[model samples]
Target chain A: MISFFKKDFLVHWRDRKEIIISLISPLVIIAVIGIALPGWVENPTKTLQIKVALVNADDEQAAMQEFRDSLAARSLPDDELLDIEQQLEQLSPIRMLKQVFQAEHVKEIVSMEELGNDDALQQLQEERIAAVVTIPDGFTLAALNKMVWNDGEGTALRIIAEKASLQVGVLNDIIDGYVQKLNVQSAFHHLLGADAGAAAIASDDYSGIGGREMVDGVETVTSFQYYALAISIVFALLLSVTMASKAITEKRERTFQRILLTGSQPFHYLMGKMSAAFCLSILQLSIIILISHFALNIFPGRSLLFWLGVSAVLVLLSLCVGALVVLFTALVFRLHDETANGIAFIFSLIAGTIGGSFVPIYILPDWLRSAGEWTPNGLSLAVLLQWIQTETVADLSVPLVKLAVFAIATIGLASWCFPRRGRI
Target chain B: MLEAMELRKVFKGRTAVDDVSLFLDQGESVGLLGPNGAGKSTTISMISSLLTPNSGDVRLNGVSIVSKPQFIRQVLGVVPQEIALYEELSAYENLKFFGSIYRLKGKQLEAKIQELLEMVGLRDRQKELIKTYSGGMKRRINIAAALLHDPQIVIMDEPTVGIDPQSRNHILETVRLLNREKGTTVLYTSHYMEEVEQLCSRVYIMDHGRIIASGTTEELRRILSGEDTLLLKLDKPNKDLANVLRSLAPIRHVEETDNGLKLIIAKHSSLLSQIVQTAESHQVEIINIHVHTPSLEDVFLHLTGRTLRD
Candidate 1:
């Protein structure tokens, strides 16, 4: 087994092009993307300024104020007054919408400019603004009627942006949050009636809803920190494929058979290939991490313990990637080299996307985000990112266990697929 | 001793080895001769334990090794038809790796590698990468790799295919030494009849997945004992004269040639004088006349009616 591993190690070392490509490709990708992505993701307010038109088109503001004054003049009972006040708060959709945009994260993401309908639409087309938010006329009155009387009428807000623009999605997310909050309020009013709803609303806690925790006292995460680890996972997978390709070449050259005939078992050959991949992955991961830590300064400025935790997670991830490629190669052992290449490339893309190697997990749909966290790559990055945020290794146990299970399952599958006494 | 009894292997409903049985004494050299796709490789693969026979079993010494292949595998050395050594590694490295697999290490492994390299006549070039070596040189290293462990039996499957004559001769000489000096059993397989004829004490001829014949070279040649082949080198071509000679009663078969005519007749037939006289009468001068001995090639043609290379 040692002999098999040594042969594979020495062979890969002799291939200067493979070694160079494995080490250099990740840095190049990270550098290109790190330089190309807008700096807004790193420091939203200090970087590129995206403009949003916040149009207040509600013409019923005067009427709603007059209604509130009339209710006060009618000398209503104390409990009735309190119920009306609670209902008024629930009916303030425009206020709720304005507050969501005013939040720190969104405020940093886009600068709002109040504009008329025509000017906002014109600005959006001219690319002066990323999106336009139009509060329709009678929006306040409609919202009030829906909440106070359980009216079935619906109100709509208009948003205009270029198709598939990132800012449009961000704006939609904020609006969705407001709509969810309104639904919760409406449900409570229908369940308890105005008097009981007022009591329930007063006692209900709203502090935790849509709340953001500052990691290391900073609300923003740098894009470099993301790709620093994301690209490392991607490149680690590609390097493992390169190792698998070398294994295939050895099979084609008949050296694999030679080793087997020398009394090395099939799993011994697998161990050799796995060890080579694991060793290279560690080297690749170490170099990429160290560069990100020291040169790029993308890693959290934490002590050695923090980086050690991060490294431990990455090591497991690297092993999983290596084992994954081994299984992939074994499954496609009879294919042509080109087909093998195509499979590897397509697998990398899919695993990267599903594992959050190309995009941050938090930005994905909830189900997909959950799925990404379970994947070896995403879990590794999650652990790293978590360690960076908490500056501790407390949240690493689950991911480490997951990574171990993934590695074992893949290695077992690969071993089972490997031919025991024949050419593979 | 290694014994294979009634071994059969069917691949996807097509039989590759059919009820084949072979045995090797501790020190005897055995050869398997056949054309391409003739089941020689399949037979060796079964004996090497790299492949399992669908039926029957192979035994080393006394025990069947089908379930416990490593027992025989440990004592066996196989050099496949392909150049199976790592091309990117030096000959020394390749030998060391194989030696390690056989559980040899330290100075002992180094000494054995040196000895095997010397045996294959590649000691001075052991440090060069195999990729840098000539085809013949690579073949020598390939043979050297198999001998590193000094196994009880060495199985070489067409080891000299596609190499220069020098390397082929070197490999033959190495096998001769292993069999003659060290008394190591060998099972040599090849399509090259001359290689088997030169090295094998006993030979097995296979065609279409079954052994056609097995014997010493002389014993196999005796299959054609009753016939004598006569070759006449003519000074000039004469189809009419050849036809006239063919009408003689003793002649069994006559085949035209570029420079001569080959005649097959009864072993005891004394028709050479009659044929020469007949040729001279037609003004067809016989420049030289020679008798042809039956070779393994003739035996193969007699059995399969196809050349070994075909």
Candidate 2:
């Protein structure tokens, strides 16, 4: 058995170019994916800078002068005069709206460009601006009347954006929070009247629900980790295909017969082949993962135990690769050499595709994603990604068990199809 | 002695080996001779325990080895028709791997590989990959690999199939020495009649998955003793003259050749004089004429009605 293992290892080692080439595909995949997916893999807390046209048609000074004139005409008593002054001080709706766009989080995410309503719509249609927020010419009187006296229709902040873009979603959520806070302030004003209502508005916190809290000071997995795992599984499948071809080449070269003549049992020979494949695959995965970790920083903030858990899952994946190679070679050898090679290549390609090695699983249709998860490498990628997010052995149990079952089934079929001596 | 009794094998409803049997004594160099697809390889495979017979048994030292293939394999060295080697690895590495399989290691395995390499005339090129070697060199290494374990019986199946004359002669000589000097039991299978005629004391002539005849060369040739082969070497081609000679009553078979005509005649016939007179009348210059006894080729023709390479 040792001799068989040593022979396989030496033969593969002599053709080191193939090994290097195999390692290259996965790296290229990970690099291309990391570069292609820009914002998705980044820290969720990172803000987006959207250029929005702010069409403010409100004439705030004119509205304030009109309100003071109306109050002077009343010639109110001393207490009534004090109450009116306080109400006037609290009635800066234009200032409040401006502050909404200037808040710390909102300011980082959106930059306001003041423009006429017609020009804002033109910029929006041309796609030069991400969105348009039009504050109508209602000025402050409408807001003050609607809030304190409930005498007129409330002013609306008209927002225009493309339905498909992330900018639309961000702007909509932010505006929704503002509307909610304003309603809370309105309710307090109705209950306590104008003088004490100003205090209620001060305490209203409009931070959106999607805020990121630093958990254990550890960052979540980046986009690099997703593609790194994806590419690793893909190349591992390719490696299995090569291994099957290698077995066929050996059979053609007649080296398999020589080994059989040396009194080596069929089981011993297969075990040696599986062992060599497993070792090489594990080694390949380890190199790829470590390079991605240290160079590309795939799973930043992962602990030692996290990596160890990853290694354990990778070991299972590598064993599955080994068994898959055996099964593919055995099954293909039942046909002519050329036909067998074609089938093996097609099978590998299908497995890679369904395994989400080329495209991210989340982008796939729901049914396809579910179907892909049942595939060998697909399950492996899913379990691994989950483990990266929450490093726990329990998360790997289903995939690990499924991989074991798959390995057993493939190995058994391989044994059944494997040609014994004198048959070929 | 290694013995195969009533061995039979079927592949896809075709009888590849049909009730064939043969034996090799402890120190005898036996040859299994047949044309291509004549079941010689199949027989060798069964006898060497690399293949199992469907309805027969093989015994090593009077005990059935069908259930104990490891025992038979341990005592058998097989050189298949194909090179059966790792072309990417060095010749030395190939030998080391095979030696390890037979449980030989360290200095002992290394020394055996060196000795075999010297025997096969490849000692200097041990470090080179087998792929870099010529066809003849590969054949030599192939033989060396089989002999690594120094098995009690060496079964070689067409070992000299596509090599140069020098390597071919080298391999025949090497097998001869192994059998003569080391007293290794050998089962050499081939379609080359001269190789078997030169190396093996006993020969088994197989045809269509059955051994048609098995005996010493002299013993097998005696089957054709009643007829004599008349060899005539002429200066040039004489088709009309050869046709006239074929018309004679005493001639059993006449084969026209580039130089002359070969005729099979009765053991003591006056056809020789008639043939000479006819050749002179046809103006065909006779370079040489000789009457010889039958050989293994004739024996094969006598048994199978075709040449060994048919």
lDDT (0 to 1) per candidate = 0.79, 0.81
Look at candidate 1 and give me any clashing residue pairs: none
Candidate 2 structure quality by residue, lDDT tens digits, B1-310:
8888999999889999998888889999998999999998888877877678899999998888877777787888888888888878899999998899878989999999999999999999999999899999999999999999888899888999989999999999999999999999999999899999999999998899998999998898888888898789998888899788778887877777567888878778877677878988999888998887798987787677677877
Best by DockQ: 2
lDDT score of residue A59 within candidate 1: 68
lDDT of 2: 0.81
**For residue B191, what is the lDDT in candidate 2?**
89
True contacts kept of 1: 0.62
Q: Give per-residue CA lDDT, model 2, range A135-252, as digits (tens).
A: 7786477776667666577777888885557667778777777766667667777898766676766543445523444467433656888888888887887788787778777677
Note the DockQ of each predicted structure. Answer: 0.39, 0.40
TM-score of chain B in each prediction: 0.89, 0.94
